[model samples]
Target: MSATRPPMTAVGADRLRDELEYLKRVKRPEIVAAVAEARAHGDLKENAEYHAAREMHGFNEGRINELEAALSNSEIIDTERLAVAPRIVFGAIVDLVDLDSEAEVTYQIVGDLEADIKKNLIAVSSPIARALIGKNEGDEFDFVAPNGTKTYEIKGVRYK
Candidate 1:
């Protein structure tokens, strides 16, 4: 049996690709130059600059490999190309309201690598997103948060 690949938005995939390209085409060469310059300074045993450059090179290469594998393994979902639906799903931008505080908030369900809480991009596997999935607008659900259980109402759900 084949293992299911994780889902990722097209925007997230593009961002990872851009980072990979930058690391390969720009950071890699810059680190190479730094290593060469450090090597000219003299003995490798006591050269801090050489050690730092080598460490940076190793980290850059590792990240490039990680990004490549993630991009290849991910199932890119383009929200714009999908059929619009009221129910929440992967890559759906959802608008929600706090029942207790009456506070309004928005979040986009994304892949693990793309989830940024500061930007309100929630991962599909997150507690809130899992609760919101398959639910329609006007539906209410109770979420057990770190603070406490909070009741929320789905105000809207959009594909894009």
Candidate 2:
């Protein structure tokens, strides 16, 4: 991991914590039981059930460790505590209008871990997010999307 801490929204951090808890408290025990059951019926040389159960156990443990590391290395940012600002910023919900198509869309600037395009959550380091940052409501700017260059007008910017 880099020495610099990666930024994560408070909500994202909470979600990771919940997943970690579930893996440790629920999934881990379940996998352990499955492995034990498989072991009881196992032949040492060619035990498919035992091998499958062990593979699942390894995957689950790896995920648990990944979640733990992510939580520990992240800088959790709380959007609710941020002072409401007119300019777009990290964790800000921004409303934008495509200049050519006149289509309106909403996006929340979030950390990499929490970014889900389907959910309108854009990563802070994304091309659009980088363009959106520091822009105020009604500001229009050109963005070089993968498709082509497009202009977008900031319709609104809210911290929460």
Per-candidate alpha-carbon RMSD to the true structure: 1.0, 2.1
Global fold similarity of model 1 (TM-score): 0.96
Shift in Å, residue 159, candidate 1: 1.1
Question: Which candidate wins on TM-score?
Answer: 1
Cα lDDT of model 1 by residue, 1-160, tens digit:
9999999999999999999999999999999999999999999999999999999999999999999999999999998886756888899999999999999999999999889999999999999999998999889999999999999999998887
The candidate maximizing lDDT is: 1
| Tens digits of per-residue lDDT for model 2, 24-125 | 999999999998998898584588888888999999999999998888888899998887578877899998999999999999999897789999999999
Candidate 2, residue 126: the lDDT equals 96
**TM-score, every prediction:** 0.96, 0.90
Q: What is the lDDT of residue 77 in candidate 2?
A: 92
Q: Flag clash pairs in model 2.
A: none
- lDDT of model number 2: 0.90
